[model samples]
Target: MDDAGIYTRESEYLDCYVQLGLASDRVLAVSFPEESDDEDADHALLDRIDAYLEGEREEFDDVAVALTVPTDQREVLETTREVPYGEQVSVERLTRMTPGLDASSDEDHDAVRTALAANPAPLVIPDHRVRDGPSGAPPEIEQRLRALEGL
Candidate 1:
């Protein structure tokens, strides 16, 4: 069953590669359109996400989301928000992006990976921009997003 207050969206440009669900103003799930089993949704939030996917805009900072993430994970995810379109950063590099994070520890490095794996907002935060990083979108979707960026 769908979570209460969640909405579904499919990309017009890369509808095959991207479909997303939202809950409480935040992205809840992301997948290939073919893989999504979501009800029809035409909320403003979905339109904003689709607009971003189509390259008509940049930055979802105004979208306003409420995520239930740990302080460390939230910091990593927030840093990803600065990753410009068509750019990619490695997980190891992302680990250091967070302030005061100990880059020398193996555990600290893995924490970035773990945080990414639990990302609640994918395209909005653009998790695909992280090289070889965890993605809420499918492989094809990630590829499609990159392709749109002409990468």
Candidate 2:
């Protein structure tokens, strides 16, 4: 990137669904379409996504993503990131899977949904792995991610 923070998250991947900033391969952010602007694609980072889409099991394990989510939702996001590459889980299930999460509590449930809706990194974090519940990711992105997972 020409400048660290100056580099926009927008990049030239199909539909520009991914926007990321890397200085010496350390990720600054991987944002959504609305959250990104045109920036150079980190080919190596993109390659891992492509590899996963092409049926490779691993997904973005080596790529670091910088996020600014609230502490209240950190457990949810971290748990979502651990979802198996080709598996799907409902938001309810995610909440239950997360330690000390109470899916039955409306406040906790909303917190989980809100965190997912604002997920900046879709494929990398695989928010689309969420099924039978609201997915905050773009429809196209969610569809594509599901397709890759063979769902």
The TM-scores, one per candidate, come to 0.77, 0.75
Deviation in Å, model 2, residue 87 alpha carbon: 0.5
- Runs with alpha carbons beyond 4 Å of true place in candidate 1: 1-4, 16-39
Give the per-residue lDDT digits (tens) of candidate 2, residues 81-124: 88887888888888888887898887777878887887766777
Instruction: Give the C-alpha miss distance for residue 62 in model 1, angstroms.
Output: 1.8
lDDT of 1 by residue, 1-151 (tens): 4333655555567665345555545565555556456666767666766777767656676655556789988888888888887778888787778786777778988888887888776777778888868876666776777777766
Q: Tally clashing residue pairs in candidate 1.
A: 0
Candidates in order have lDDT scores of 0.71, 0.68
> How well does model 2 score by local distance difference test?
0.68
Task: Report RMSD for candidate 1.
Answer: 3.6
